[model samples]
Target: MASLAGCLTGEEESENTLEVLHGWTGGDGAEAADALFSAFEEEHSDVDLNNKPIGGGGNENLDQTVSTRLNSGDPPSAFAGWPGSNLEQYDGVLGDIQSDVWEEAGLEDAHVEEAVEACQFDDGYSAVPIGSHRMNDLFYNVGVLEDAGVDPESLDDVDALIDALGTIESETDATPLAMSLEAWAILQTWTVVMLSTQGYDAYMSFIEGDGDESAVRDTFETLEELLSNYINDDAASVGFTEVNQDIMSGDAAFIHEGNWVAGAYINEDLEYGEEWDAIRYPGTEDMYGLHIDSFIYPGDNPSPEATATFLRFAGGETAQVAFNQYKGSIPTRSDVSTEEFNDYLTETIEDFEAASEKPPTLAHGLAVDQSTQSSLEDVLNNNFADPFDVDAATAGFMDAI
Candidate 1:
């Protein structure tokens, strides 16, 4: 079990200890975090860093645990989190790190535009981003596309994509798109559908809470058709990992997911650009849908100096490169080089820079607050997935968000 006691503000037993709560207990996430932790320990040998990893996809369990600790006046010195309004939940407890970390660590100039935007609040900076995951990725199996005589590069728009799905269904035995009906999965696909069909401005308007009802209905209609027609038969029963498996085995042609899916491919020893590939979601080439994993500074900090050291390390170029290599994300620092990463990451780094807009993803708590995320998830997955009700889904989204 992880310790509740935080770092040494000279009052604690472990005077040089620093506790960090994160959700990277297994697989590539764990490996990537271990690399980061090892590097930190190597640099700061005096401080005993308590690495508390709470296992859960999307930090579902970890977030609640951190909240409980913070409420009990036992906040970790630093904790991993998403950027944007997600930080507002812990507003009272989160301390201002603008001068301590942002300015001191040179993050203001080094980090990407979206990272800076997400980290800043009216009062002060809420967090410092460690990595950036592009959420608008459509991954596909190379051999399946080749055998079906369909060119992945030719899919320039939703119409082209729909026609290609038809071509894959008719010409090959592979499933057109691997999917899932798990609430988060449904919400994830729905977000992509909105971007691919409604375009960037419409997607942004919806995320910001003043969505156009007609466009919302239209996006819902498009998602309903895509989920109803092209996805694998077992989509309702499977999840994201299963979908990745289906695509890699050539049983499915495509799966729309975040760049974190790259870690799975890397784990399997699959070659990028040859065995599989990812593209900017059709109709979203100009927009980079981003999901950032960051770290927060808490007000109940046991060791302010220790936490500052940790934050400074996290924001450094060396640490960013080390953490993101296996974490399945690109460095939030734009200065980090792509030569150290795989082809997919290198391309994503370029795409992120060239894109006109880097919009935070909705399902992952980057674009909206935690409440809004839960509301949308419940509204879409429960009302739309099983029933495929566009009117109800649109109505729920229009009201809830």
Candidate 2:
């Protein structure tokens, strides 16, 4: 069987059409995929690209489909994913991207090095670093902050941010913080809070395939503090889409989410950098905003041509800027000019750079494999529900991992 690399390169019978698969289905997902495909078509007029977006609402179904396909000796030319420990699963279906081009693209050496080392299977570069979605960003309404007599930037620490949310809730009859109770959204939001307060060392240990009980316990304790202050009584009842609407309509004062919220705001024709702004979740000042998108090349099947083209384009500065701007993610290549990005994005980039200057906290999903990821999600779900038993939750989590 020809590898994805060979398929990408036209080594096999010219399948000029590149079939890119992802889990983005509707809403912002559709917008993001459309932006990338449109850019690809504009650039490579000769290549017919088919962006096969399979699932919606953070689709796990499509992820399963793609994984099943890859494991069954079939894989797309390139697939969207997050780079982390799980790249080990697809042992040899990636193509090696050239080192020189990577450097030339102005990808910070550390970012490239991390992706290469962590995402690599055995052969070479397992995946190209696409734009990153900072998971821990908190979006809030400026009026809400002003009405509460609080400075938006004052939320640099966890305790301060919680107090601010509480004050805002008390002063205005609005929900202080709005979040959907959906499993993934809850888990991702909590994961951000956990990573921020618990410190990168512990977060990285868990992400790097180590299950540190103390780290998990600390994270949970911090989450308990945060949940006590922020989450509203009706949290368990609302969906993410409704949560987004609440935030947009100013019914909720704050939302902890990824960069895509900006895109969602844009789609709603809501004013940004004025009505609202985004900040890295409180206490992440020393951490790089979490990087949440990955594209891995299969090593065993080796589609050198296709893989090369895909990696080159995926990592290139032009593609990075275009995709990220429309998708509302930070560009992977730091060299690209983000002048068009609003104040919130600029502030996020500044924070990310500062965090990088220290050390990085790997996204929890990246640090751990699928099994551990599932376990953590389950633990988080139970914790988010009632009867908040920290010990039982921690015990169940530690045992599962």
Index of the highest-lDDT prediction: 1
lDDT, candidate 2, 100-172, per-residue tens: 3345444445354555455555544567777776676788887777788878787877788888877987898
Best by TM-score: 1
Q: Candidate 2: which stretches are off by over 4 Å? A: 1-14, 92-118, 205-215, 232-234, 237-239, 267-269, 299-307, 356-364, 382-384
lDDT of 1 by residue, 75-153 (tens): 8988998878888788788888899888898889988787898888657886888998888889999999999998988
* Cα error of candidate 2 at position 83, Å: 1.1
Look at candidate 2 and tell me the lDDT of residue 283. Answer: 77
Each candidate: how many clashes?
0, 19
Evaluate all candidate structures by whole-model CA lDDT and list the values in order. 0.85, 0.67
For each candidate in turn, the TM-score is 0.93, 0.83
TM-score of 2: 0.83
Residue 71 miss distance in model 1 (angstroms): 2.0
RMSD of each: 3.4, 4.9
Off by over 4 Å in 1: 1-12
